[model samples]
Target: MTDTTVRSTGRLRGVLDRIAEARRGDSSESLAAVFLLIATLLALLWANSPWGWTYEAFWHTHISFTVGGTGIDLDLQHWVNDGLMALFFFVIGLEVKRELAIGELRDRSQAMVPLTAAIAGLALPAVLFLLLNPSGPEASAWGVVISTDTAFLLGALAVIGPGKAERLRIFLLTLAVADDVGALAVIALVYTDELHWIPLVVAILGLAAVWQLRRLRVWRGGGYLVVSLITWVALHESGVHATLAGVLIALLLPVYPPKRREVEWAAELTKRFRQSPNPEYARTARLGLDRAVSVNERLMRLYQPYTAFIIVPLFALANAGVALTGETLLAAATSPLTWGIVLGLVVGKFLGITGSTALLRRKLPPGLTMSQVAGGAALSGIGFTISLFIVDLALTDDEALADQARIGVLVASVLAALLGAVVFKVAPAPEGPSMELLRPVDPRRDHVRGPVDAPLTIVEYADFECPFCGKATGSMRQVREHFGDRLRYVFRHFPLDEYHPDARQAAEFAEAAAEQGRFWEAHDHLFAHADALDRDGLDAHAAALGLDVERLEEDLRDGDTANRVADDDIDARTSDLPGTPTFFLGVTGQTPTRLEGPHDAATLIAMLERMATAASPEAPRS
Candidate 1:
């Protein structure tokens, strides 16, 4: 194993660190799930009430748009399923693109566990469904069982999962993403029986045009909107589900961590706007800030609310309104179609996800025990939104069969949520997991910058190429100056190499320098020239620090240097850190407490100065 390989192996288990950081404080998932549940209840009530005839009558009402002797027409339910749901899928597509481009799924090796488990989760459900409904019209609705509604899964976890279930959430989020992709593929490939070749070709052409626009750096939303609409229409005209238009177009849109240059430019513009207080400067600053973030994130921010808060609940209202008369319920009780969906979602999902993960438990992040995996697996059985969507597609010829499947869906969702809650309430909590550093700092093994036996110490879990960590340079510089020989500062490698592609290599360079007894020098040099820490740049750093360049290069190749970095990485991840630039302050020979922010220079300096004064020899006793 090379140095890069060591870091890669460490990251393979720690990929959830990035996803957790991305969604540290958000809680809207539960609220959105509430809306979906309410809508489902309302749908049930309306379909079974004295006004039940009104339910069918209202949804069957036709709506049409015609211009230039050509137009589109569909009933109200179709409008919700085909029109509004496309936006929902578009939001999902944006998230998918974000993950594939820069999020946890970017690293194929690191993503292998969840991806494999998700495939099992998807396949086993379909197989179980087919086993029950073999060689029949009901068998075609197998797609109904192959999905987990992400919104409901998240909401259910928050309500009933363990207190500190962040790691579990991250792991399940990755699996859910893969599950969604698999479901979308089934929707595109299996459900679409008829095809219009010419319109399909036109749709492909429209997608190609959108790709070209992306390549040309066209940032205008209007330009993409016009093209996306054209592609959606063509796709709809073709026999392929129009919602797939959102997925294809979103995949073409770019996603990346904000670049340092663009961020600096945005900052400069904002500074100028503050000084000038002019409209022109304000406009420039706004544009600069917009340019700093990627198009993928911007679209997500714009559309995700509509999808989560409105479209999804509306979809539930449209699709979940099954008439549950006594006869319908009695027939469904003995229906193979109903039983297949129930077993496929609840039993198959649990067995598939939990079984696959157990076989690959070594790749799981520490503190993510099998208990939590079991609970999350049970929750993956909530196949509501896409299940109903597929029921409409697959059982369009038989309304009674569709009703049975819908009841099965409703029953499975409730069962899955209850099972998740029960598993979580009964399971033992993680074995006394602690967020404190799992490994203590040692001068011989750690990158220390001052006296080994100093009175005060600060340990930083950092990524070399993280812009936020890079921004902390001023605070660290001030601390160094203030403490001089009194404070010992330690650097531990915690590279989020998915977002910062060059960070792992830069950390390896630091390790190479450690072998040459110049780790601190290499640390400062790498941070100072963070953007240029590629292979040649690291070579330049080794040579400039009076280290043997050939030996440094050889050390990086030998993998021992990377092993040192990976050891710290494993410790950092096991501790469940918030993210890079996390700090711990403590006295020598004692466990450090994490320093919750106001991590700015002036505030930290003042706080530390007061601490120093209180601990002084001449201070008054309290």
Candidate 2:
């Protein structure tokens, strides 16, 4: 390719890679929630438009199928709720299984605080709802008040920036997951119709068939889908909510990683693929890769995006279109059912969650403070998706009650989000620095970019091969240009060996370059040619930077050079560093403000300005 073409292609590829990285993280969740919100607004507008009757007509239109002298029928709304939502529940089940197996719920002690708080949060809402509607049909709809929408809550937290309340976000997520479990239990036990014994028995047998399939190591996607469909249909016929079948099947799936023997066999197969370039070897290698990961993880990767982006939004579009006439508004404003839902979610969640945390303060996790608990509790009241869901299940026969419940949810969610945002804004920064930049810069051992006595210092723990670190290098250069003599920049090594195999050796080489006073030159060269960072590449760069090639090679072999890199690694671990390109800025004796992620130049400069302003003696303390 020509030079211009190659450069353009490289830039395009860089953009695509960044986009892919974003989709893999919390950004995907945020995007899905945004789409869901948009669908909800469209539904509301459509229902209130001049063509309002079309909204009901379209969603209520029946769709039916028949086979072998039997038929099944459902309206468009019911199809979305019963069929598409089953997939959504399946994804939830996968998340729950993953958490219990390896994520937050893996530790009993760590999970206790949120688990207890979730129970309290659920119970208080039901009590409030019951008090408002004591022996009436409305009393049965208490489940609508108990669920906290995970997507909307997480999306709002992301917008709020988890930097100030990282622990608070964790607490909220755990509480929401626990709340989901409780809500699922309520659906299965409280909302079911009359039981059909034969269909229930058939459903149990289908679950056993799923268990047997896993035992036989049946990994084909189609086989599992067919069996799960059978289980779902049987559960539906049994008069239990078919969505619960998703949770049951997910719990039964194998979550264990490949056994040691299987791993060894995969390694052997990979070696054979390398030796012989045959199709069979390649196919076996692919199978080996698949076998190395658990079924739960594989299925989550396959299904999470579909459920989030498509199924959930369709559910919202079908369910969120409640017409708001003048009479209906007046009734909702005065109705006990509406007031019950609104107050139960908004007031009860905050009181219950915060009260429970305070009551158990002595036994709970040390990371959470009272202010954080309060803020998280406020955010927990932003219940949208699942609250609307339970409304459909609980008040299915009473459209007036369902509309009242929907109105209550909409108003409550907005108020809760606003209240939580205000609480977070006014809350004090948590006690002590969460991250400690403890390693002092030694003039003799460290390579410095600016004056040693500069007012502000930025210490970066980075890996040479990390793309985010490469992006951060440009931002650091901009920071130096903006601050000049006021900033002192220090670099530290933190090579992640699992992801970047050559990074540790590269760090040692950079340290060796520091011995010859060309550390900065080597640093720039390594990042500029990040794709080519082997031993020969390092030597070539050192030569180009005017270092004595012989001395450079000798210094690389010296044990002290490797020891310097190891020291930085130890410091990073001690600080509980999250990832590469993590920045810390402050003066001596005071704790530094820790900034995570690959921030842009403007953001870094803004943070420095804030730090400078805060450090000024004239500045007033809040």
* Per-candidate local distance difference test: 0.82, 0.79
Tens-digit lDDT string for candidate 1 (404-428): 9999999999999999989888998
- Judged by whole-model lDDT over C-alpha atoms, candidate 2 comes out at 0.79
Tell me the TM-score of each prediction against the true structure.
0.73, 0.69
Top-TM-score structure, candidate number: 1
**Candidate number achieving the greatest lDDT relative to the actual structure:** 1
Q: Candidate 2: give the clashing pairs.
A: none
lDDT of 2 by residue, 17-51 (tens): 34334323456767877988898998899989999
Pairs that collide, model 1: none
Error of 2 at 516 (Å): 43
Which 10 successive residues of model 1 have the least lDDT summed? 16-25
